[model samples]
Target: MWRAEESKEAYEELKKKLMEGLRENEKIESILKALKLFNSRKDRIFKEVDDLEELREKIRRAKEEVIENLDEYIEKAVKKMEENLCKVYLAKDAEEARRIVRGIVGDAKLVVKSKSNACREIGIVDYLESQGIKVVETDLADRVVQLLGEEECHPVVPAIHISKEKWSEAFSKETGRDVPPDAQAITDASREGVRRAIMSAEVGITGANAIVAETGTIITVENEGNISLVSRVPPKHIVIAGINKIVPTLEDGLNIAEATTLFGTGQRFGAYVSFITGPSRTVDVGLETTIGLHGAQEVHVVLIDNGRRDAIRDGMKEMLYCLNCGSCLASCPIYMSIGEKYSCGYFGGIGLSFGAYIFGAQRAFVDGLGFCTDCGACSEKCPAKISSNDLVREIRRRAWERFGLLLPPHKKIRDAILETGNPFGEPPEKRGEWMKSN
Candidate 1:
């Protein structure tokens, strides 16, 4: 949505941030540690799978089928969820999604939320705060970033930039106590406050890692216990997720979740894997089921289309296969250098593809597409086998076409392509000259 000048300025600012990150030893160390963990876990997964290639093929087929049948699956999901006592809303865009959530959360004073990238994309927290609602982030990493007023540098670990020493200081300031510079101490301090907030909050919100259409379930994968608390404690539970997250069946959703966890942080499985069908209910009384007996009395699932349907229609169908594992970010030299400080919406090479639609070409260009090396490292590590480097190059080509700002070398290449049907500048008649000479 940024103008040309604004986009250009954003690009320059991103370059500055990259340089700053390169100079920060602590940040570099953190990235290296994450990379190490990722590699080790990847090796384990490769060894654990009995048929690696078969699994990849199955997953690829499954994802393709789901995307192709997205509309049908969504309809089924809505019906099944409603039958389970969960209200469903289809949001056409970020603004509409936010408005729908606002209407559902009307007059609620306090809300607790888990780490959901969808929430960030829709700007829900800021909008809610503007309307005088208090929202607390339950994820420890999310809490750290929220307290410091910084964006998440990584999908799984929001506070990757914060060192233990600095994090302890922040926690101490937040808690008004001299918290020790230890991981446990900081976590304990945050947990104590968040626990109270969760219990007293009027509503809880989360993002779905995947949705099962047949079972009408929302699947969330997390390493922390925060999401469990966030989804259960409040009287109302809301899930906001992109339409692309829907799968045909619960098994398919689990497969995606497993791959996401393995690739996301090198974990064999997430510490917490939650599947919510609807409001918590019990069939203990005379074999008759009662809704909202223990957990949230009301459940709402807002499936957001936003720019995803447009993206699929506009020839970016493969981009929707993204699992949001953050593996591409870990593998991308550009992402590792600059972090996600400049990405308009999501982060990493896959983020560039989504950005082109969700944030516009100008913003996507400024986000990091111009600086990509096109080495295909990201695609190699991607769980879904998305060619992120190729996507970035295509976006760049589109940018060049629309903007009409060609460097001299690019102009020459364009001229050659137009003249010879290739960038080599060879005439059609001379196509076989090289073979003859050889």
Candidate 2:
């Protein structure tokens, strides 16, 4: 759908924009501040719960069990989904998924999409546009970035890297009308623009935070109401989600969703939580079954593998447990400093790992992984405790093995450290010479 070079360029531009948003001195401080807040909140939330550690262990086991028996679970999910009259498709890669969506949307001019990083990861917008479909992102944050024709810097807050003033200017240009540089004015303009897309969209696409295998339900959570509009207003709704997002039951899905919301955005619950089971159906008058009256008539769920199965087999399965809350991105020192360019896809710690495998290490390489300060802030704040820093190190090692590419400054510093104890390689006696003289 999209070339590797184009994706790399997009990532670099986003990184530049992110760095421009932060003050030189405030970057690390702000990252640490956010980390502290997140850590404190997590400690408080799980402090009194005596069984949290046990629950985490159980979840890990459950996830592992599912993965171990992945084929069976996938079959069960497909059977259950089909039984409910909803279409289910298994896409091995991005191309198949794109083809399925394009076929379903056949000649549709207007399509509205919810904020789905999965879709973004697969290059859905570029693919659809290639087929002459006009896809509009309905999420306010997504809409802002789409109008500006830029990649998202943050997963949760797509436009967080952009200031309100810039948004006001963008809105003024898009609407050809005067707009005040105020929060309300900017919000109103974005809302209006997204609303129009939602109301007129012939097809809608969204990403599921979790899919319940037991109940054949797709779970979506969002702070903005755009997800609701995306699912309800359009005549046809399609969900593109990673296969790892599946859970054994609705209760398990709810637990994962709740934990993601709490830790991801520091919220008790999202503003809109939509759980759609099959398409809208009613058997009211004279035992006649009706579909699509209240919401979308047809619902299609595409379980995408891409490289997730390989990742799971490679012992990087823990990454599949991500809820895409983007908590790590907010707290990552590297991400805060370099912004979105730190990685290729998704953003933040997980993105780095995914980028290495998906985009390849050479194309995704940035600053020899020196962008990361190894502060462990991202892992500390990650609800899943994903060990992002360790993953980055592994990625770097893999890069060297695969491409024989060494990270620039880090390679030099590492060699210096090996030759001598200090990175500067100054004589041991000179280490204290400056202190003694000054």
Which candidate gets the maximum lDDT versus the true structure? 1
C-alpha root-mean-square deviation, candidate 2: 5.0
The deviation in Å at residue 170 for candidate 1 is 1.8
Model 2 residue-pair collision total: 1
Clashing pairs in 2: 15-341
Model 1 Cα lDDT, one tens digit per residue, 257-320:
7888877887778988999999999888998988776688899999998899887887777888
Cα lDDT of all candidates, in order?
A: 0.83, 0.75
> Ten residues in a row with the worst lDDT in model 2?
23-32
Model 1: ten consecutive residues of lowest lDDT:
402-411
Q: Per-prediction count of colliding residue pairs?
A: 0, 1
* Residue pairs of candidate 1 with colliding backbone atoms: none
